[model samples]
Target: MNTGKAHKSGLRVVASHSSLWGRFLQGDRHAFAEIYEAHIDDLFHYGMHFCQEKERVKDCLQDLFQDLWSSRAHLSPNVLHIRYYLLSSLRRRLLRALRKDRRYQHRESWEAFEFEYTLPQENQLIINETIAEQKRLLHKALSSLTRRQREAIYLRFFQNLRYDEVAEIMSMQVDSVYNTISKAIGLLKKQLPLPLLLLLLGK
Candidate 1:
C-alpha cells in the first residue's frame, strides 16, 4: 500500500486547514464558520462509523462545536488535519455520552466501538480506472474485514492519515496500527486477484 502521492496530498490539506485554524484562533468569526462548514460533513460521517445513533452523533457534533468555541482560548491553535483532531475529540465526547446513558457500561474501552464504511457508488469507483468487476471484488474484501481492521484500513488508506495520525485517532500505537492495516490488507489479498487488490487499495 504505497501512497506517496496521497501522503503528499495530505500535506497540502494540512497546510490548508492549519492556516484556517490559525485564523480561527485569532478570533476571526468567518474563519470559525468556514472551519465548521468544512468539517461538519466529514465529522458526521466519521461519527456514524463509531456510533449507531446518528441523531446522537449530530447532537454530539453540535455540543463539540459549542464546547470548542467556549474553550477556544485553551484549544490547539493549529493542526495538520482538522478532521483528525475533530474525530479524536468527537470520539471522547461520544464515549462519555455512551457511558452516561449506560449503553456501553460493559465495555471499558474504545475497542468495543463498531465501525462500518459504506463504499461509494460503483460509478464513483471508476474515476481511477477501476472497473465494475473490481468494485464488486473490493466491496467483498472490505466486507470480510472485522470492524477494527476495516477502521484501520479506512483511516490509513481512505482518509490518507499518516500512521502516527491514525494511531492518535484510533488510540493505538504506531506499530500496532501498521500491523492492523497490514493484516487487513493481507486478508483482502487472499480474496482479491493481485491486480484487483492493488487497484482497489492503491486508489
Candidate 2:
C-alpha cells in the first residue's frame, strides 16, 4: 500500500491548505479568492444534500464566504483542510436558516442524504438486467438507512473526509462515527456482491 508514500501525500495536503489558510487570515485577497474557488462547488453540493433548495444553498454560500472574509482577522490559523472548514460553516448556516423559516418547521432534523445513481447513455445500454437489479437493491438498502447513517456514509465516502473529520462535522463522537459507518456498511453488504459493493461505495 506504499504507506510511506501515502503519509507523505497526506502531509502535502495538510501543508498546502494550512498555508493557504494562514495567507487568507493575513488578509491576502488572492488567497481568499482561491479558497472560495476551491471549496464553493463542494460547499454547494453538501448544502443541496442538506437542503434541496438551490436558491437557499446559493444564498447561504454567498453569506458564508462574505462572513469568512469579514471575520478573517479573528479566524483560527489551524485549519488543515479548507474544504472541511467551509463545509462545517455552510452546514451551520443552512441549519440555522432552515430553523428560522416557518415553512421548514416540519423538518425537525436533517433528513436522510438523498442521491440517485446515473450512467452515461452508452454505459446504460450495456448494463445487463442483473446489474440493474443489483443497483435497485443497493438504492433500496441506502434508503432504509437512518439520516445520520446516510450522512456518515456520504461524508466518509463521497466527500472523502477522514472519520474524525466526519465526526466533528456531524457533532458525533469518534467511536459513534466508527459504529455508524460499520453498521451502514454491514447492511449494504447484504444487498450486493462484495466486488461490486466495494466499487459502488468508493472503497
TM-score of each: 0.71, 0.78
Instruction: Give the alpha carbon lDDT tens digit for every residue of 142-179 in model 1.
Output: 67777777677767766656777788877898778777
Q: In order, what lDDT does every prediction score?
A: 0.72, 0.77
Q: In model 1, which runs have C-alpha deviations exceeding 4 angstroms? A: 1-18, 104-140, 193-203
Q: Candidate 1: lDDT of 173?
A: 87
TM-score of 2: 0.78
What candidate 2 gets wrong by more than 4 Å, as runs, is 1-17, 108-112, 118-127, 193-203
lDDT of 2 by residue, 1-203 (tens): 23223322342343544578888899999999898888878788888888889999999999999999999878878777777888888889998999899998876344548757664455446555556776777678767777888888788778878777888999999778778877777776675667466445442
What is the TM-score (0 to 1) of candidate 1? 0.71
